[model samples]
Target: MPPPNERDPLLEISGLRTHFSTREGTVKAVDGASLTVPRATTVCVVGESGCGKSVTARSVLGLIDHPGKIVAGEIRWHRTDREPLDLAALSPTGPELRSIRGREIAMVFQEPMASLSPMYTVGDQLMEAIRLHKEVTKDEARSMALDLLRRVGIPRPEQRFGAYSFQLSGGMCQRIMIAIALACDPALLIADEPTTALDVTTQARIIDLLRDIQAETGMSMLFITHDLGVVAEIADEVVVMYLGTVVERGGVDEIFHDAKHPYTKALLGSIPRMGAGTRQRLTTIRGNVPHPSDRPSGCPFHPRCGDAVPGLCDVEEPPEVVFGPARSARCVLHAMERSVR
Candidate 1:
């Protein structure tokens, strides 16, 4: 957790809506989402697959291509010296946004193979990224590239720099991606399921590397993943999303120890814990998340939520219920409890 006296937020998102137009129908990938990333804080967004975690991050970076568009939103970015700028309004391919994309705010995607170019040498790519953002000579960029590789804990970075992406293992490729993303010293880093394809041991190493880098740089990060274990490992705050909406958000301890939303409770209950005695099967949340085009009428989660009250959860959307100084949830149970209190 960060200190209460933190002055300004690095990124502020409000009423964000991102929709994708398909032949079938428009998919509301991100609907009215909002959150804040305080400077030097890590906010982990956890949800099931297709819950809009990645879409929200892409929307912030203006990375949505052809079929997708930002219907409405305000993404305000506050740099160290300059005034805050609304990123949502900027042109997708404009020079200003491009300048900020990798330099001010960078993203490390889920699949390293997809992100890294197979044809380009790692050194060429990293050096090009450095030279693109900063007015550094080729020699200076090369030095910086090797330095970043080493900083990300890549063994024998100098030797690895000249290697192709395919030559490195999954873990090494991911570390290279992280190194490239951090090459410009970005103020905000968005990691979208960075360790999804790696083994358990490799995943732990990546998580540790991120924590170490965050501590060293004091940069804000938005870690997006579906894994609860990853959230528990790296998040200062947790945002639980369902069908493009944030059902609950709070400090890590608060969300884990005293989750208010029924969906959140179900999610926590689903995680397998050690020493719980052998059981025939692990607990599972019933029903799949509805498709974006076929979302339920009222609460998006009502169909799968076991504790959803009859009338309130099915007929009307619940208001955000503020529980403590830094915790809130969008759940009818929480709303009714607060009203009764």
Candidate 2:
């Protein structure tokens, strides 16, 4: 694939909605969420658990299943030489989609143990992934897999290659997952909390590995995580989600230093800072994320938002306010606050 340029977005998710049809009610996992993943840049989607970060990533890969569907929206996958493919319009399980999935796009899931098969050796799975997207002989695939394992910093890759997922530590398994995801040299990588279950050191290593890989490959990434520290470390852009919707999006620095959405501010405040008073309780966003089936109307976060205008935020949905060329927020208060400024 040609190296991603700044001319156009690599992936554009517009008004996307992924919902599950449960017996009780429809669970709006992703509610009209839209964001752009620019070429060769890292866009981190972050929120509390169940805010639809994973669902959005899964929807991009057409992995949403059973009673859950991409109810609305367009996932436009831009091509350098051809027309953009509307992933949302394609058959979720069709051959065309399958061809694009592993070859053009790849994903490293949250749980490495669960994502990897216990039945297959790490080498077996890795080689299979390589061979699936490339016309390679068994020896060639094996060589590529070994090379990837080494690239991902799996020590003694040859030794670990024959081991099963269950036989490896969580960090090792996650490294294996990254190796598998990179085997095909996909243009885009969707990493949904790839470091979630690892130790702090392992998490830092994983983050560094991903950054190095991105630098070498120039592949665009959509990283889903709840860790603001991770977001600050890796993101070129940040998309803050709450209750299945994107509340704010901007440059990493802009989001961190000048967050406009109440939800985003609350989330930033909740991140544990170095030298914060040992005895002082960490700031907490006052209420739990509403269940998908029970999402509040208007501003999904208004119930806990300190700056919420009762009559406005509680009664009417806010329109997205464009703060500048690259900054925007879906919050009524942003417009009012900006007008005052």
lDDT (10s digit) by residue, model 1, range 146-214: 999999999998899999999999999999999999999998999999999999999999999999999
lDDT agreement with native, every candidate: 0.90, 0.91
Stretches off by above 4 angstroms in model 2 are: 1-4, 279-281, 337-341
Q: For residue 17, what is the lDDT in candidate 2?
A: 98
Which pairs in model 1 have colliding backbones?
none
Q: What's the C-alpha lDDT at position 198 in model 2?
A: 92
lDDT score of residue 114 within candidate 2: 99
* TM-scores of the candidates in the order shown: 0.96, 0.96
Candidate with the greatest lDDT versus the true structure? 2
**The 10-residue segment with the lowest total lDDT in model 2:** 1-10
lDDT of 2 by residue, 1-341 (tens): 66546746999999999999999989999999999999999999999999999999999989998999998999999987888999999889899899998789999999999999999999999999998888999999989999999999999988998999999999999999999999889889999999989999999999999999999998999999999999999999999998889999999999999988888888888766778777656668887999999988888998998888978998889889998866899988776676799
The Cα error of candidate 2 at residue 80, in Å, is: 1.5
**Which stretch of 10 consecutive residues in model 1 shows the poorest summed lDDT?**
1-10
